[model samples]
Target: MRRPGSGTRRLAGARVPVRVRGRGRDHGSAAVEYLGFLPLLLLVALAGVQLGLAAYAAQQAGTAARAAARTAAQRERADGAEQAGRAAVSAWVAQRSTIGGTGGCPGDAVTVTVTVTIPSVFPGVDAFGPVHRSATMPCDESN
Candidate 1:
């Protein structure tokens, strides 16, 4: 008689095959694992893209605010401040953006604020909101 997988002993009549643990049950497990991780991978990708969009929106808001404030500071820029603000940002951002200002007088300081909505790149996710930026400049008193 011989033990399974034991070379020290010899069998006289017949041979026996050794059974491996988890050999049959482990099939297709890799595919299952990949499927389980698919959602998490998708989440990470979406988060990365959404973060980029939010950052771009914030940058655009700052640019718009600066342009608007600069124009508002000029005494003759009463009607052009908003236009400048809108023009300073990307068209997609401008479509969903708002520009406003306060305290731009001949002798008064000017403050311009720009707000842009940060669009979500992930489907069914609306956690991100609008980004706001403000700028101030001295009004041109020489007007």
Candidate 2:
């Protein structure tokens, strides 16, 4: 008996509610909440990436150190310990990584150290220091 969308449904003497609202006071606030939380989301993502980079750097350092020690342990390969270590790692990492060694096979054992800078996920951020790993191998009898 009422016209379509008459804009109002007036009863005898009271005005009827025309617009339906959600039961909660914060209805339709999903978009606003997400926008407000965007910074936190970005921060978490960057932290995850940075963590991965640090782990990778540590692993690379270990690998390089082991390779260097092994090479140095061999009398024939002692001269190329550092080079062997560098060759064992990825080019990018080797470029940024530093290699060192001490206690050669000439004495009793060979030890090598690898230090790799932790790459950053965010530009211009170098808050992290280098990852270090050391390896030692018994010297070959010939050495």
- Identify the leading candidate in terms of TM-score: 2
lDDT of 1 at 134: 93
Collision pairs in model 2:
none
TM-score of each: 0.77, 0.80
**TM value for model 2:** 0.80
**Residue lDDT tens for model 1, 32-114:** 99999999999899889889999999999999999989888988766688889888888999998989874455556788888
The sequence of per-residue lDDT tens digits that candidate 2 reaches over residues 30-99 is 8899999999999999999999889888999999999999988998878888888999999989998888
Model 1: CA > 4 A from native: 1-14, 19-27
lDDT per prediction? 0.82, 0.85
Q: State each model's C-alpha RMSD to the native.
A: 4.6, 3.8
